[model samples]
Target: MTSDTTRTEPVASPTDRLRRLVARTEVVLWDFDGPICRLFSGHPAPGVAGGLVDWLETRGLRGLLTEAERHTADPQVVLRAVDRAGLGRGVAAELEERLTQEELRATATAMPTAWADPLIRTWTALGVRLAVASNNSPRVIGAYLAGRGLADCFGPHIYGRDAALHRLKPDPYHLHRALNALTAAPAAALLIGDSPVDHEAARRAGVTFLGYARNARKARLLADAGARDVIGSLEPLLRVVRERGPGSAPRPQQHLPHH
Candidate 1:
């Protein structure tokens, strides 16, 4: 299904982007990283939405994170563990703290190509609840949001590690957690993200996937994998939610809102 999804004259606009995105479904189950947040690792780092990821892997590091941590994947929990691991290489505990401080001073965590705040606001305004299903440490996710002043964008529904030790994305555990949290269901929900990993995770979990074209090649791969929809912008996806109406998408993944 990884074919290029080409649609000329997108029936979407900046002002009505959220409205259009909301048309296709209800709750918007979103991915982090290239979709909502941007990583601000320095120098050799290619920066968010660029080849920073490739840069990291090229450095023998999966990311600013450690090995066991990269395997963790879910930003919601991985960083939290890494923060405590003090066990990994690359970033010494002291150095991690120092760099994290530096990152906080500059990056706002939102992708230049994304408008996470409005997307959330529109969904909420449409009476649609939002939930996070990431593969990182809750602490890091929390810190990233707070540091960027985006902690309120998702309210308290952020699910991270410490919540589910062995349950992460592509395993469908986070999906289950989101359902429980939002009281949502898989069939009725839609997940939007920018990578094959996100596509695989949603497919394995049984939720509809909307491959955001953050990476053209990855987007093609996701479409080939059977994502229900694909788009380069959040506007169209929001439109999709509105079309789906209330209770039409997957339910929340877990219970309780963190912080």
Candidate 2:
């Protein structure tokens, strides 16, 4: 007679988990607004969203947005709401362009996330592919990256939102595009993002996600979304990458088991 038994594996600490994730990541898909820089840090997102709402009101299209959407701090929320309102392409295009202009202006005062620039450069030097998979317009991403002198780091692999408002995060469209452009398997790519939508997008794309939570609230939000790895700062990741050294060979690609 044989007795039934079950074995449990030891849980990996957060640092160990991050090291393992970084070791296997051949490509990194970065979200723009948070992971790279706070695009609206100087312009302020609430004001930008309000400006868009005010613009729509001037055009007598205020009814297109629900009360909550009109008060949203995220411009994307307003854009998505307008897209779902069955508005004509002309209206959508104008709205998108307005938002794009605001993003462009915001880039003038965009605040880089701590240690982000150095980490990006270090990772690129270490032979890792990089791409910007963001909801911001590619034009804005390009302008900002160019200003930072990091354009060559991503080259043409910067994927962003277009007129198709439905393809944003939680849709996994951009992540898939980045993977295809880099010719990297999903298991070999990792996305560093700051939102639940980013986590969902990575999940759909079969890519690993590392949440960048800049505050306690953001950390809690990512944790609540079932993210297995969350960091309050990019410095830890930067340090880990440095310690891994330039000659560190990438581990074989394998799908990270979902928690």
Q: Stretches of candidate 2 above 4 Å error?
A: 1-8, 249-259
Once model 1 is optimally superposed onto the true structure by TM-score, how far is the C-alpha of residue 157 displaced, in angstroms?
Answer: 1.0
Error (Å) of candidate 1 at residue 187 is: 1.7
lDDT of 1 by residue, 163-225 (tens): 333454666676667766666666656777777767887778767776777667866787777
Expressed as tens digits, the lDDT of each residue in 1-259 for candidate 2 is 9999999999988778889998888989999999999999999999999999999999999988888998999999998987788787788889999999999999999999999999999998888889999989999999999999999999999999887888878889999888876777898989999999999999998999999999999999999999989899999999889888877847435443332
> Candidates' lDDT values, in order?
0.56, 0.91
- The residue-level lDDT of candidate 2 at 140 comes to 100
In terms of lDDT, model 1 sits at 0.56
